[model samples]
Target: MLLVSLILLGAIGTRLAVLQLWQGHIYRDKAENNRIRIVPKPPVRGNIFDRKGRVLASTRLTHAAYLWPIVVKQPDWPKNLKYLSQLLSIPEESIQSRIEQAGYNSPTLIRIARSLNPAQITALEEFKTELNGLEVDIETVRDYPNKAMGAHVLGYTGELNAEELKKRQAEGYRLGDIVGKMGVEKAYEQQLRGEWGGIQLEVDGAGKVMKVLGQKVGQPGKDVTLTLDLDAQRAAEAALGDRKGAIVAINPQTGGVLAMVSNPSFDPNVFSSQITPKIWKQVQSKGNPFVNRALRGFPPASTFKLVTATAGMESGKYPPNTILNTFAYLNVGGTAFGEWNRAGFGPMGYVRALAWSSNTFHGQIGRGVGGPTLIKWARLYGFGKATGIELDEEAPGLIADDAWKRKNYNWEWTDGDTVNMSIGQGFTQASPLQVAVMFAVPANGGYRVKPHFFDNNQDTNKWRTSLHLKPTTIKTLREGLRAVVAEGTGKALNVPNLPPVGGKSGTAEAPPGESHTWFGGFAPFDNPTIVVVAFGEHTGGGGGSTAGPMVKQVMEAYFKNNKR
Candidate 1:
C-alpha cells in the first residue's frame, strides 16, 4: 500500500514538472500577447438639407459584419472562417474572397455584409467562442431618405480605391473609408468629414472584449444647407421623366440654384452598400448616369440670339429700329445660312428678329457686330467661365474668337462663324446654368449676379457685377422678350389665368441629324422671381414645342405654390 501511494505521488510530480518547466514560458507569452487593443471608431457623417430644411442626405446606425485582417492570418483561419460563415449564414468562400480583395494582410477591417438582421447579430454574439476575430461592428452609413431624388446634386459615397487611399492617407483616410465620388458630396468633402474616435479595449486571447479601457468621443461632421428647393426640384425631375435632358432653375435675384436635375440618376444608397459588379455595370451602362447634365455645355440654338442682340445693341452697330431684309437665306463666304422659317418674314427689325427668331436678321446683326465684338459680349455675359456655384464638375462654356479658333482648330475666324454665333450655333457652347444666368441679365435689370449654392452674410452689392447695359437698351430688350411669349414662337408657354411670362425658344441641330431643344425665360415679365432653362437632347422638335411647355409647367407650379 505504501509503494502504491509513492507511485501516484511521482506521477503527480512528473505532470507538475512538465507544466512548470517546459510549457510555462509558452503560456506566459500567450497571456502577455493578449493585450488591451485600440479599436478605431468611424466618424458619423453630417446630414445634408435643402433650402426648406428637408433632409436630402443623412446617416443611419447599422451593423456590419467584418473580418479582421490580422486575425484572418491565424493558422486555423479556414476553420474560424467556416464557423463564422455558419454563424452569419454567409458563404465561406465569399468571405475569404472579400478578405483577399481587401488585402489579406491589410490592417483595415474588411466589411463582409452590411445591415445585419437582429437574429444574425445575436448568433454572432452567441457563437463568439467559435467565430474568432469575426466581429459585428456598429457603423454609420449614408442614408438617402428620398432615394434617387437629387442624386446628381447630393452625390454618393463609396469605399476609397488604392489611388484615392494613397492620395488621402495623410488626411487620416484609411482603406475601407467611404469618400464622396461626385457632385456636392465631392465638393464639400472637407466640410462633411468628421473627426474619428477610438476605444481601448481589454480583450481575451480569442479577441473577445472583457473590459472597456478608455474611449475618445468622436465629432460628427457639420451639416450643409443647400440653396435647393425640394418642391421645385421634384417638379423639375417629374417634368424630365425618362427623357435624357436637364433643367436648371435659379433665383435671378440671389443667383441661388433652386433646382438642378439630370435625368437617369441613380440612388446614392446603392453606392453605400457593398456594390456588386452587376450593379456597377448597370450604373455605367445607362448614358454615363454619373454626369450632371445641367452643368455640361450644349449648343444654345436660337436662344443665343440674345447674346448677338446684346452685342448689336450694346456696340451701337444695330439699334432697336434697324431693319434687315430677311430673305430665305443669307450667303456668307459661300455658306448659305438659312433662316429657321423656309418662307421669310420679309423685313424684320431687331426686336421683331428676336420675337420671330429670325435667323437671317440675327445673322446679319452678328456680322455687323463682328466676331471679336460678339465674343467679347458673350464673355461679358459670363460665358466661357464657371458660374461660381458651390458644386463640382461645372464646365466653362466655350466662346470662340480668332485666337481660339486658330489654337483649337487651325481655322480662321470667318463671317460664317459670326453668323453661326449670332444664331447661337457654330463653336459657341453654354451650360443650362449659364443660359439661366444669361437671361437673368434682362430679367434682373441688367445686374450680373454671382451664382452660388450656399447662404452666407455678404453684401449684395459685393456679389453683384454690372453688365453695363443702357437703361433704354435694357427696356427695349425686355419689351422684345415679352413680345416673344405674347405673339411669337414662345406663345406655347402662355397660360390662360396666370401672369404672362416672357422668354425665347431655341433649337440646335445635334449629332446624327437630331435637334437639341432649349428654352430660357423668366416669370411675370415685370417682377421676375425665377429664371428657368430647360434643355432636351435629341427631342426632334423646336424649343417652343418641346421645352417651352416644361418651362411653363415648372413656372406654373412655382407660382401656384409660392403665390407671391
Candidate 2:
C-alpha cells in the first residue's frame, strides 16, 4: 500500500510540473487572446491639389461599425443582425454580405458598415454590451470637394478586393485597404498610399474596450500636386458643355497639361464611399462616362493636313511655293473623291491649300509623299502611340501602313488609302492630346513636347525632341496655319481683340455617323505660349464651326487668367 501510494503521488507531481513549466504558455496565450482585441488605425489618405494649391481631393473622418468574428458564433448572426438592423437601420443582407466577404475566419476585424452617422454611433455604443461581434471605430473616406470637376484626373478610391489583397499581401496591404482605381490616384498609388499601423487593445468578454495596451498611429499618405490649372479646366469643360467631345489645353514649351476636359464626366464623389447598385448602374448608363475622351482616339480630320504638308515640304519633292493643281475631286480607279466644295481652290501653294483645306490638293500631296513616308512623319510627330502621360487609359490612335493592312485585312495599301489618311481619315486616328502634341512642334520651334499631367521640370531635351525641320518648312507650315485662322477654314477662331491664333480645322467623313470635327490651335501665333486642341465627335458640322469656338473659349480663359 505504501509503494503504490508513492508511485501515484510521483506521477501526479510529474504531470503538474510538466504542465506548469513546459506546456503552460499555450493555454495562457489562449486565455490572453480571448480577453484581448486589436483595433486598426487606418492611415489617412493623401490630398490632391492643382498647381495653384486648390484642393482637388482629400479625406474626411467618419465612424464605422466593425464585427469581430472571434467571439460571434455562426447561429448568433440572425438575431444580432436583426438587432443591428433595428438600431443602425442598415440592411441585414448587406451586413451578411460584408461578413461573408471577410469570411468567418478572418484574422482581422471586419468592417460591416461605414460612414456611420452620430445617431448610429450612439445607438451602437448604448447597446454595446448586448451586441455581439460589434465594434465601432474611426474610419477615413475619400472626399472630392470639386465633385466631377476633375474626376478623370483625380480618380476615386475603393476597398481592396480579394484578388487585390492576395496580390499585395506581401506588400503589406490588408484586405480592407483603400486603393486608387483610376487616373492620377492610380498612377501614383504607391507614393500616395502610406504605411498602416494598428492599436493593440485589451477588451472585456463583451468586446468593449477595457484598457489600452499599445498603439501605433498609421502614417498619412503623401500629398500629390498636379499640373492642372483649375481655371483652365473649368473654362475648357464649360466650353465643351454637354457636347460629346473633349478639349486639351497644354503649355506649348513644356508639354504640361494645363487642363484636360472630357464631357459627360462622372462625379467621383459618388465613388468616394460605398457605391449602391443603383448608382453603379447609373454611372454606366452613358457611353462610358469615365472614359477620358481627351485620351481617346478620334479622326484627326483636317488636323492631319499638317502632317501631309510636312511630308510635302520635308521630302523636298514639293517646295514651299510649289503650286499643286486641284479641282472638285481626284478620280482614280474609276472613283472620284469629292472635296469640301464641289469647286476646288484650283492651283494653289502649300499655304493656300492648307488655309482652304483643299482635299484634292492634299490628295496630290499624299500621292507624292506615299504611304511609308507619311506614316514615318506621323510617327515622328508622336501619333499612333500613347504620350506616356500619367494616366493609363490613353488610346494609341491607329496609324496603319501597308503591312498592317495586309495582316489585318489581307489587302494592299492604295493611293485612295493614302488620300484618306492624308486628310486624317480611313484607318488614321489621333487623340485630342496627340493633336495637341502635334501642333506643339511649330509652336515651340520644331520640338515635339511630350504631354504630361505632372509638372515638367524635366530636362528639356528628354521631354521634347528637336524635329531638325528645315527653316523654310517651319516657316511655310506656320504661315499656312496662321492663314487658316486669318481668312480660311478656321476663320471663326480669329475673334477680334483676342491674341493672334493659328490653327488647322479638320472635318472627316464618318459614313455611318456624322463627320468628326477637329481644331488644333496655338495662341499668340508669332510666339506661341499655349496649344489647345478641341474635338467634336460626329458633330456633322465642319471643324471651324463645330470645334474651333471651343478652342477659342479655352484660350481666352487661359490667357485672361494667367495674365501671360
Candidate 3:
C-alpha cells in the first residue's frame, strides 16, 4: 500500500511540473499573441516638383473619422453613430452597418469620413470623451496645387484595392494604402514611395492607445524634379483650344520633353480623394477624354512622305534635282490618286514637288523606290516600332510589307498600296510622338532620339550614346526638311523669332469625309533647338492650315520665354 501511494504521488508531481514549467512559455506566448496587435504605418510619399521648383504634387496631413467598434458601449452606439454620421455628412445607417459588420471581438477601424476640415475636426474633438466609438486620426493625403494642370503627367494617388494590394504586396504595399495609379506617379512608384515607419504603442484593455512604447518615424520619399516647363505646357494646351488632339514638344539637343498636351484632360485632384460613383460614371461615360492621344497611333498621312524622300535619295534612284511631271491625278494599278490642288505643277523638280506636297510626285517616287527600300527607310526612321517612352499603353504602329499583307490579310502587295504608303496613306500609321522624333533626327543632324518625358539630366549623353544614323544621311535629310519649312508647304506658319524652322504638313483622310490634320517640325534648321508635333482630328484642311498654326504658336511661346 505504501509503495503504490508513493508511485501515485510521483505521477501527480510529474504532471504538475509539466504544466507549471515545461508548457508555461508556450501558453504565455499564445496569450501575448492573442492580445498583441500589429497595425500598418504608412510612410510619407515623396514630393513632385516642376523644373522651376514649383510644387506640382505633395502630401498633407488631414483628419479622418473612424469608428472602433470593439470599444463602443452597447447603449451609446446608436447616439454615437447618429452624431458622427451627422457631423461627417454620412448617413447614420451607414455608420451603424459598418460598426455591426466589424463586430465587437475584432477591434476594426471603420472609416466614416476623410479630409475633414479644421473646423469639423475641432467640433468632433469636443465630444471625444463622450463618444467612445468616435475617433479622430491624422493621415497623409495627396494634394495637387495646380488643379487640372499637367493632370495626365502628374497622375494621382488612391487607396489600394484588394487586387492592387495583392499584386504589390511584395513591393511593400498593404491593404487600404494609397498608391500611384498612373503617369509619373505610377512609373516612379518605387523612387517616390519612401520607407514606411510605425509607432509601437501600449494599449489599455479598452483599445485606447496608452503611452507610446516605441516609435519609428517614416522617411519621406525622394523629390522628383521634372524637365517640364509649365509655361510652355500651358501655352501648348491653350493654343490647342477646343480641338481634340495632342501637342508634343521636345528639346532637340537633349530629347527632353518640354510639353505634352492632350486636350480634354481631367483634374487629377478629383481622383486623389474618394471618387464618387456619380463622378466616376460621368468620366467613364464621356467620349474618350482619358485617352492620351499623344501616345495613340494614327495615320501618318503626307507627313510620312519624308520616309519616301529618304528611300528615294538613299537608293540613288532620284537626285535632289530629279524632275517628275505632275498631273491633276495619277493611276497606279488602276487606282487613281490626286493632289490636294486639283491642278498640279505641270512639271516640277524633286525639291519643288516636296515643297508643293504634290501627291503625284510621291506616288511615282513610291513606285520608283519600290516597297523594299521604302520599308527599309521607314524602319530606319523608327516607324513600325515603339518610341520607348516611359508612359504606359504605347502602340507600335503598322508597317506593312508583302509578307505582312500575305500573312495577315492574305493579299499580295500592289502599286496601289505602294503609292498609298508613299503618300503616308493606307496600312501606315504613326503616333504624333513618333513623328516628332522622326522630324527631330534630320533636324538635329541624323541622331534618331528616343523621346522621353522625365528629365534625367543625362539626356544629352543618352541621346549621343544611342543616336541611330549616318552623318551624311542626316545632313542630306536635314537640307530637304529645311527647304520644306523654308519655302515648302510648311512655310506659311513659320515664326519670325524661330530661325529656319523645318517641317512637314500632312492631311490624312479619315473615315468617309473626315480628315486628321498634322504638322511636325523642328526649329533653327541649321542648329535645332526644339521639335514639335501637333494633330487635330476631323480638321477639314491640310496640316499647314490646321495643325501648323498651333505648332507655330507653341514654338513662338517657347522661344519667347527662352529669348536666346
Candidate 4:
C-alpha cells in the first residue's frame, strides 16, 4: 500500500513540474498581453503655404470615439451600437458600416465616430461607464482653409487603403494612417507625413487604463511652401466660372506657376473627413473633378499652329516674308482640308497668314515641312514629354511620329494627317500647362523654362535652348502673334482698358456639336511678365470667343495687382 501511494505522488509531481518549468513562459506572455496596451499617437501633418504666406492646408486636432473589439463581445455589439448611435446622433446602420470599414473584428481598434461636437463629447464622457469598450482618441484631421479653391493643387488626405498600406508598411505607415491621395499632397507625402509615436499603458481585463507605463510623443511633419499666388488663383477660377475648363498662369521670367485652376472642383474638405459612398461616386464620375485639367491632355486646336509656324520657318521652307497662296479649301489625297473662314485670307505672307489663322496657309506650310520637321520642333518646344513639373499627375501629351503611328495604329503617316496636324485638329494633343510653356518660351527670351511649383534657385537662363530657332524667326512669330490680337481671329480680345496682350486663338473640332477652345499668350506685348493659357471643353465657340476673354480677365487682374 505504501509503495503504490509513493508511485501516485511521484506521477503528480512530474505533471506539475512539466507545466511549471516547460510551459510557464507561454502562459505568462498571454497574461501580460491581456494587461498591456500599446496606444498609437498619430503625429500632426504639416501645413502648406502659398508663396505669399497664405495658408492653403493644415491640421486641426479633434476628438474621435474608438471601439475595442476584443473587450466588446459580438452579441453585445447591437446594444453597444444602439447606445453609441444615440449618444453621437448617428444612425446605427452608419455605425455598423463604420465598424465594418474599420474591420472591427480584427485586433485593431476601430474608430466608429469622428469630428465630435462639444455636446456629443459631454454625453460620451458622462455615459462612459454605460458604454462598453468605448474610448475617446485625439485625432488630427486635415483641413483646407480655402476649401475647394485650390483642391487640385493642395490635394486631400484620407485613410490608407489596403494596397497603399501593403506598399507603405515598410515605410512605417500604419493601417489607420491618413495619406495624401493626389496632387502636391501625394507628391510631397514623405515631407508632409509625421512619425507616429506610441504609449504603453497598463490596462485591466476590461481594457480600462489602470496606469501609464511609458510614452513617446510623435513628431510633426515639415511644412511645404508652394509658389502659388492666391489672388491670381482666385481670379483664374472666377474667370473660368462653372464651365468645364482650366486656366494656367506662369511667371514668364521664371516659369513659376502663379495660378492654376480646373473648374468643377470638389472640396478637399470633403476628403479630409470620412467620405460617404455617394460623395465618393459623385467625385469619381465621368466629370473627373479630381483630375488636374491644367496637366490633362486636350485637343490643342490652333495653338499648335505655333509649332507648325516654328517648324516651317526653321526648315527654310517658309521665310518671315514668304507669301503662301491660301484658298477656302486644299485637297490632299482623298481628304479635303478647309479653313475656318470659307472666304479665306487669300494669298498672304506668313505674318498675315498667322494673324488670319488661315487653315489653307498652315496646311501648305505643313506640306512644306512635313511631319518629321513638325515633330522635331514640337519636342523642342517641350511636347511629347512632361514639363518636369513638381506634380506627378502631368500627362506626357501625344506628339505621334511615323514610328508611333505604325506601332499604335498599324498605319503609315500621310500628308492628310500632316495637314490636319498643322491646323492642330488631328491626333495632335497638348495640355494647358504645355500651351503656357510653348508661348512663354518666346515671351521669356526663347528658352524652354522648366515649369515648377517650389522655389528653386534654378538658372533658367542655362535651361533655355534656342531650339535651333533663329532670332529673326522668333521675332517674326512674336510680331505675327501680336497682330493676331490686334487685327486677326484674336481681335475680340483687344480690351481697351487693359494693356495690349498678344496671343494665338484655336478651335479644335470635338464631337458633332462640340469644339475645344484654346487661347495662349503673354501680356503687355512690349514687356511681358505673365504667360497665360485658357482652354474650354465643348465650348462650341472658338478660342477668341470662349477662352480669349477668360485669359484677358486673368491677365488684367494679374497686371492690375502686380503693376510692373
Residue pairs whose backbone atoms clash in candidate 3: none
In candidate 4, the residue pairs with backbone N, CA or C atoms under 3 Å apart (3 or more residues apart, or in different chains) clash, namely none
| Candidate 2 Cα misplacement greater than 4 A, ranges | 1-26, 81-107, 118-123
Candidate 2 residue-wise lDDT, 189-248, digit = tens: 987898888877788776667888988878999898888899999999899888888999
Q: Against the true structure, whose lDDT is highest? A: 2
What TM value does model 1 have? 0.88
Backbone clash total, candidate 2: 1
lDDT of 3 by residue, 117-169 (tens): 78788988898788755667887888888876777777788766656767888
RMSD of each: 5.7, 2.8, 4.8, 3.2
lDDT (tens digit, per residue) of candidate 4 on 1-564: 999999999999888888788888876766676677667778899898888789999988888887766556688888888888777766899778757765554444667677787888788877667655677878889999888898888777888866777798899887578888888888889999989888888898667789999999999999988878888898999999988989999987788889999977888888665555677887777477878889988878888888888888888888787888888899999788987888677789777887888899989999889988888888889988999987898998888889988999999999988888888877877999999999987786577877788755577664455565689888988888999999988876688867887899989899976888898879778788889899998877888888888988888788777776
Expressed as tens digits, the lDDT of each residue in 317-429 for candidate 1 is 88776888997899899999997777789887867787899999889988988988999889998998998887768999899888989999898899999999889898888
* TM accuracy, model 4: 0.90
Report the CA-based lDDT of candidate 4 relative to the real structure: 0.83
**Which ten residues in a row are the worst by lDDT in model 4?**
101-110
Q: What does the lDDT come to for candidate 3?
A: 0.77
Q: What do the candidate models score in CA lDDT, each in turn?
A: 0.83, 0.85, 0.77, 0.83
Candidate 3 has its poorest 10 consecutive residues by lDDT at: 31-40
